[model samples]
Target: AQELLTKISEKCFKKCIAKPSSSLDSSEQKCIAMCMDRYMDSWNLVSKAYSSRIQ
Candidate 1:
């Protein structure tokens, strides 16, 4: 979870935050939220597949 969160933070920061500011704007927040959700879904899917294969 830590590793995944770190990756999601980096990816969302690059993709959503166009300019560094005092804080994230509403749009940036929304974009990051959506990106994180998608990343988490993908991660979960991959993890399940890998675990199933190992078993």
Candidate 2:
């Protein structure tokens, strides 16, 4: 979970954030939300496949 969050934050920050700021704007928030969801979905899919293969 921590890894997933970290990865999502890093990727989303790079993709969604342009300049460093004290707080995120509405659009940045939405972008980060969408990015996190997509990353989580991909992570879950890969994890499922990896577990199946290991078993």
Candidate 3:
């Protein structure tokens, strides 16, 4: 569980963080939030598609 969480965090950070700033700016924060939502949506879609194919 812990290992899986770490990997998810790493992937999300890479997708959301284009540059290393001292702190997350307002726009960056918003982008991160949206990116997270989109990532989850994509993941769910992919999982659903795979399951349907298997069935």
Candidate 4:
């Protein structure tokens, strides 16, 4: 799970953060964080639903 999280973080951060500045800007970082969260949340929900359907 930790490794998956790191991979997701990297992909989302790369897409969202076009400019690699010294520090993550507040607003951009916030957006990236939220986007990563929602992405993972939806992924979990989807897996849950899929497993239920399969079972």
Candidate 5:
């Protein structure tokens, strides 16, 4: 879980945050939300596939 959150933060920050600021604007917030959702979805899909194969 910690690794997953860290990966999500790193990837999404790189993709969405062009500049460091005190706070995020609405667009940045939206981008981060969408990016995290997509990343988690992809992670879950891969994890399920791997688990099925290992079992």
Candidate 6:
């Protein structure tokens, strides 16, 4: 869970955040939310595939 969050934070920050600010703007917030959702969806898909293959 920690690793998952760290990876998401790092990747999304780099992609969405042009500059490190004290707080995120509405656009940044939306971008991060979308980015995290996509990352989680992809992660779940891959996890399911790997689990099915192993089983």
TM-score (C-alpha, index-matched) for candidate 5: 0.81
* Candidate 3 C-alpha lDDT tens digits along 10-46: 7778977888899988887777778767767877899
Task: Tell how far residue 1 is off in model 1, in angstroms.
Answer: 2.3
Position 25, candidate 3: lDDT: 86
Prediction 3 global C-alpha lDDT: 0.78
Q: Rank all candidate structures by their TM-score, best first, as comma-separated numbers.
A: 6, 5, 1, 3, 2, 4
lDDT of 2 by residue, 1-55 (tens): 7887788889999989989799989999999999889888988899999999999
lDDT, candidate 1, 1-55, per-residue tens: 6888899999989989988999889999999999999988998999999999999
Candidates arranged by lDDT, highest first = 5, 6, 1, 2, 4, 3
lDDT of each: 0.93, 0.90, 0.78, 0.85, 0.98, 0.97
Alpha-carbon error at 41 in model 6, in Å?
0.4
TM-score of each: 0.75, 0.73, 0.75, 0.69, 0.81, 0.81
Candidate 4 lDDT for residue 31: 81
Model 6 Cα displacement at 4 (Å)? 0.7
Clashing pairs in 4: none
Worst 10 residues of 6 by lDDT: 15-24
Worst lDDT run of 10 residues, candidate 1, spans 15-24
Worst 10 residues of 5 by lDDT: 18-27
Instruction: Encode model 5's per-residue lDDT on 1-55: one tens digit a residue.
Output: 9999999999999999998899999999999999999999999999999999999
